[model samples]
Target: MVDSAIITDNSEVLLHFDLKLEDGSAADSTRVHNKPAKLVMGDGSLTPNFESCLRGLKAGDKKTFTLPPDDAFGMPNPDNIHHMERSKFNLDAPAEVGMIIGFTQPGGMEIPGIIRAVAGDSVTVDFNHPLAGETVVFSVEILKVK
Candidate 1:
């Protein structure tokens, strides 16, 4: 058998990944668009639970598995949902339900918040990740492991 470099805690990896919901709807894919992504194994870019699954995998390896909410993006936090004043939004911009808006934080970082409802002066915006609370299937191909 040919020996290969295995993924380790500090390994730098390049990989292609496809993310899908439990119902088979596609969420994201590096193979479908853009070049393979690079990451250091211990970087917080991926959840620890998710990175654990990649341990020991080598280049040219392909893997697919389902991850529960806690293992994936984790359950949505209610605190992530906030009620905003309608006046804070641009009147020209369509503040319709389901639309994602960029909100600037006090720290000057911008985050996306999806509008859930518009009632009177209140606009319900959910800042949780879109995939939060979902069980997802991940398909990954390890292109390079250093």
Candidate 2:
């Protein structure tokens, strides 16, 4: 039998993975959508800690690992939550809690913000990633490691 190639710093990887929360709710999953993710090792595509987990694994290897909040999406930052004026939103659009709106920054980059609350003229918008501060279970099946 031929030995399979191991994942290394230069590997171009194609894999299926899932990110689930402690409550057993899936945050993201490639298998659910019938798609696989591709990435080159040592790239910023995966966090340093996350990339390390894939290192040394070979094709066809399946593994599950848990990441702390910091290692995953990271702890939520209070600064990411902003209080905006109600007039800032377009009048045609409904401004309600739990609504995700795309906000254009000074650099013209569109960033998504979730409405946390609407009180009179003040609308609290959280710019933090939806998975921020969430510890996640990451499971992966390495389909190819070239």
Candidate 3:
């Protein structure tokens, strides 16, 4: 039996997690050597289905589940790729392949874009998350329930 109220909307939880891809490739894992991640439920930071899986789980509970791309980061959008003049970037920054750069948005929010390619004067950046279209497997161990 577990305390249902231990896991509720807005509750804070500490969990050690491992995120894997469909090919059994390890994408990210806190279990390797990192502190547990702290997240507040229903904060829009987590997908509804992910949060649903945590519901009714208490401290010391462990679970593993897979989330489809749509439920995780959602599929990548073609529109997220944009080509801009190399001059638009700071020369000191030095555009390189696979480098993530932060671009300021109209709303003052910084969006991270990965450098996909660079030509003589044009640079292609992709705003989609690296894991956007990948189905992810999450293995979670609840450390604390608050």
lDDT of 2 by residue, 10-44 (tens): 79999999999999998899998799999999889
* Tens-digit lDDT string for candidate 1 (21-121): 99999999887767898999988888898799899899999999899999999999999999988888886775789999898899999999999999998
Q: What pairs collide in candidate 1? A: none
User: Worst 10-residue stretch by lDDT in candidate 2?
Assistant: 1-10
lDDT of each: 0.92, 0.91, 0.89
Model 3 TM-score relative to the real fold: 0.88
Q: In the order shown, what is each candidate's alpha-carbon RMSD?
A: 1.7, 1.7, 2.2
* Regions more than 4 Å wrong, model 3: 1-5
TM-score of each: 0.93, 0.91, 0.88
lDDT (Cα, tens digit) per residue for candidate 3, span 1-146: 55444788899998998889988999988777877889999988678988998888889899999899988888999999999999898868888989999999999999999999999999999999889998999889998888
Q: Candidate 2 versus the native: TM-score?
A: 0.91
lDDT of 3: 0.89
